[model samples]
Target: MLRSSVHDHTVSTVPTREPRYEKKGLKAHRQLAEVQALQEAGQLDEALKKARSFVAKNKKEPAGWRNLGRVLIDTRQWAEAKRALDRANALAPDNPSTLINLSLASYHLDQFEAARSFGQQATAIEPENPLALNNLGMALIKLDDFDNAALVLRRALSVRPDLAPALSNYGAALNRLGQFSEALDVLMAALKLNKSDPYTFVNIGNSLRFLGRDSNAIDMYNQALALDPGMKEGSVNICNVYNKNNLFDASFTISSELIEREPKYVKAHSVMADSLIGLGRIDDAKAAAESVIAIEPASITAQALLVSLAARADDYDAADYLRAARRFSDLHDIYRPDVLANPADDAAKLRIGFIGGDFRRHPVGYFLKQLFTEYDRERFAFFIYHNAVEYDDLSDFFVENSAAFRNINNKLDRKVAQEIADDRLHILIDLAGYTKYTRLSALVHKPAPVQMTWLGYYASTGVSEVDYILADPYVVPDDCEAEFSEAVLRFPDSYLCFSEPDCDVPVRPAPVSENGMVTFGSFNNLNKVTDNVLALWARVLKATPGSRLMLKTMLLNRQDHRERITQRFAAEGIDLDRLILEGPSPREALLDAYNKVDIALDPFPYGGGTTSAEALWMGVPVLTKRGDRFLARMGGSIVSNVGLGDWVAEDDDDYVAKAAAFATDAAGLIDLKRGLRQRVLASPLFDGRNFARKFETLMTSAWDAYRARNDGEGR
Candidate 1:
């Protein structure tokens, strides 16, 4: 193969020429025109034959070789087209068309860098070449250089506003940058240019999904698939919609077909994992995620799925999976606030900051409530930066106690970071990981100097700048330190210290003396009740014959959802008559329902958190299996911290046995329930002041280390 001119930086131009009037030149030009018309007519084979004949007769004409390359490109023979384009460019070093053909050939072969180089040369030679600019932008998109991709496409649009390719790809760049609304507008403009473009429809679907218009997005995806039945992205997105709508059966069927057709399709596998999780196939979900990891070892989506699956499976290796997910993806950077703070400030109290959207009756809020109530105002100033629009009554507590409270609901991450920095916070902590409603990308903008991740997540953040994860020895052992992106900073006792609501329910002195039926209850979210959980619960109910299990959760609020859950359990040999499901009741009424439950049966894998705490607070003993991840070990953590280790089971068998034991030993169970509330109240978990002191100590130590290193810089 001939090599093109080695002018890497400079653009190649088409040499200016007038038609030569000689007979041979006239005949050659006529043959080239005939071949070009054939190529445009989609008769690539005929075009190639005619081009080869012209090349044989007119061996010195570069146009003949360029025409052959264009034909090869049409046939998707990229490697052969590259060779022909190379020879064409070598023969006529300044041919813009030859350079452009080479760029297209490289693009088809997935050689984005080479394609970009040739595209740059083509655009430089013909500054108004919209095709060349569009090519450059597409290459940049593949390379994840969205900023420059946007710049190049904008230039392309400037030259040709109706450039469909430019608009479509520019919209994709916008999507990558998280500008979904703008991406939708750009994609709509592209659709107007060519209504038949299936790619634009897919892009529009992506933007709409991100903007929370999932139903409309599903319609767009369906339309794209209808337009081009073989579109893989649309197929995967359609499956995603099914999972989002809680239609796991449909999602699993579609994803199974997708896996068979494209075994290495990572996104499809991730979707399959979610569908499997919903179907109550924990092992299958784990396998699907493992398949994704096999294909792309560093895939963030795969690792996240694996973490959730492992947690839900109640697997002993769940914590390791969480660590692996963290290692595989850099979730977010921990800001080092001390670096950005003024030195020689030892005399003043340290300013601590909490950044997250979950300060409103959420799990993060439940854990953080104690922090605010117990924090020593004289020694430290608290700064709470809320990023969410909604706030519950609990937010009032954070506001009343915090030294500086800022509602940054509508502000972007950069602006939020500036506000935190302006407060001169010594330690900035991230409560939200990569979970939903989390603004993690804001930390990527480097808002603070010392940012760390704590509660509200169980996986690695995949962020490089994030400093550490506040944990306990039980949560992150010393040997497992290497698995985390951030350093594992072990705290004393428990990582999370629970705060008992001052308005605790009055404990009934007498437990129900009735014994004919055993009441089983769980107050966790409906999403946590996987198929495996229902199956296990069914087994327990079967073992304890004549006993009815009462399942209380908010999802049971809808009669249809209750029936669906009931039907699923019935299929596992649990009769609908044996299962009593209840909707969400008022707080006090819900607490009173604990009297009806002899023993609280916790869900496996992704176990209970606030629900478990509330159950114990209601003087109900919860039977739970110890798990590796936070979601799995909620009961274990709360029970152990509250001095109820006997209630914490080590495995599934143990959990079942404990439940049965509680049923057999009615008197003992009643006694345990009566003293449960008192035990929890007496434990250190309820001592908010002590927990706050420990949290403060950890933050100050980290800040002091940052300051000492900076202080010794001149020495």
Candidate 2:
């Protein structure tokens, strides 16, 4: 019912009361001690009554009100504590203890800036006050000033080494700075001081998660939950861990549990959407995200997920996706930093800023491996703005190779954008599109002279600030220009560039000759393999007698999903025996799946981009049909760029015919498979050097146009 721990002259608890003291000075002080003793004895109501009487009697002195404020703070009545503290401050203008109590009340009320200011005033009056110093450091950490927090916290620890709250706050600051190991060490020290602190365990879990120790992080989360079952942060964090582990069902279950308990927990709703997306339920994920937006219209988390769902839709509309995207972007306007120089600097050396979350081993990183490493150093100075949640070898490669790499991962989006603007980048490229954990909002500031979206997203970002979407002539044709917010900036050859993977596993020949049956496979995400795409694949299988269709994805592993997929195929007259379903595999094993597929089936309305590139590189010919928008036409662009025009079918009828024809002709399959990798290597699609040159030239052209448009405008 009450929380207080006595520690002699150290002033562990402050007891606030009214002016009812009959005696002055010494007797009034004795009355304050009596109130604190009553509180410590767990008689909070009796203590509060006595404090009120004392305050009512001794209205001339601030001590009665000070003691009352302290007792209110102990009861967690933050607003009431502030009222008492304000009275105490009015009576005793420079009392250090009253100032400290005022700061404590503000801290409990979540008024961090006010807390810091009061703590500063207290410290100035009594420079040796460890309590004030620790309070100020805690407020600094809350404000995300990790460096200043550490400094202030160190000063507090110097005065009182065993302060558990200071240690915990400092550790949290270290975790935010990405110093996980040191954070863990400091957190352990805090745990030693106060083993029952559930929040310390949550901070420990966060550090462990960031350090890639997922199992340990989960263990720490459990420890926190065991101590405090109602801890919202612990519940949400463990759910996030499950989502990251691809245990979507578990994540959804936990989030649902949280929702049932506290329906207004919008963060849980955002996590639920991520779980739905991972489960291959794009429509359900979209609904979940929309619900969060309904609750919190400006929620960036939900807005980004909504955009991701639109981008991943079976019937993706670039115009529709753009409109959805601007809803998120327009929520806050980012002012152009005053430091932005005149257009006179447009003629200066190229300074490029590439911002995104996937500067790690994700799809965006896999695609940019060649460019980040080989983009001509003398011509372009890179400022890689990495907003990463995790790290891998590719992350290091980009950071090490770039002229300057700033990890603005934990920084606010607008502030991070201003940092980019301060870099004076001539070309700012958003590699993350509308995907999760993106800086598309930052681009709204127009940080650089030339802003473009490329590689990461296939569709147009609705923001008018984005100048162009890098494309090949085949990808964004003249007819598709009106659907896009950005102008189509096409390359002479292809936009789908490739570099040799770190693993150059030898390519095997077509599976048709040995197996006696041509196998059609699509290793793309199951969400992309819509019902219509499945029906077409079924048609191809029925037309080509004795052929098998091998489908592999993370979803295929789930028994429920596997059965659903089987039933869906059976409804189309395709036997379960003819369908070979597979699930998640190791990287090398996934590449080996290409050896089993004679022809790769590119899923439509949302076809493959990286999957198609990988299929061709692994010596499997991908048959793709042209479609309306950028996402649908990725396969067409990839295949046509590698000089496989015959493989690009015109319609659904033509698609089935091509698959059947290609299956029957084993000789042609073998010939195409054998020569495919080399053809890709020689073509513009896989030419890294040529790709670098052309991309640089294109960037230069964009810069020149920016200069021409704003010749006199210094923006």
Please report, as a residue range, the 10-residue window in candidate 1 with the lowest summed lDDT.
1-10
Worst 10 residues of 2 by lDDT: 1-10
Model 1 lDDT on a 0 to 1 scale: 0.72
lDDT by residue for model 2 over 1-715, one digit each (tens)? 0000000001122322333533568877898889877877878888788888998998866777877877777777889988988998997787777788778778766688998898899889877667777777767666656677778778877887888877777787777777889989988998898888777888888888888898998898889889979876777788778877777889889988988897876777777887877776778878877788788787666777777677667777677877887776676554434233222264345888888878886777877888776788878888888776577887898888887988887665557767887887788889887776577767777777778999888777877778888998787888778877888898888886776667767788888878788999999888677778889999999999999999988878888778988999999999999988999888778887888999999988778877888889999989999887777788888888888889999899999999999999999898888888888888887888888899999988887777678773432
Error of 1 at 187 (Å): 2.7
Per-residue CA lDDT of model 1 for 219-326, tens digit only, reads 988888789787767878877777766677788888889889889777778778877766556788778878977997765456555554544454456356656545
Q: Which candidate's TM-score is highest?
A: 2
Q: Quote the positional error of residue 502 for candidate 1 in Å.
A: 14
Q: How displaced is residue 141 in candidate 2, in Å? A: 4.3
Each prediction's TM-score against the native?
0.72, 0.87
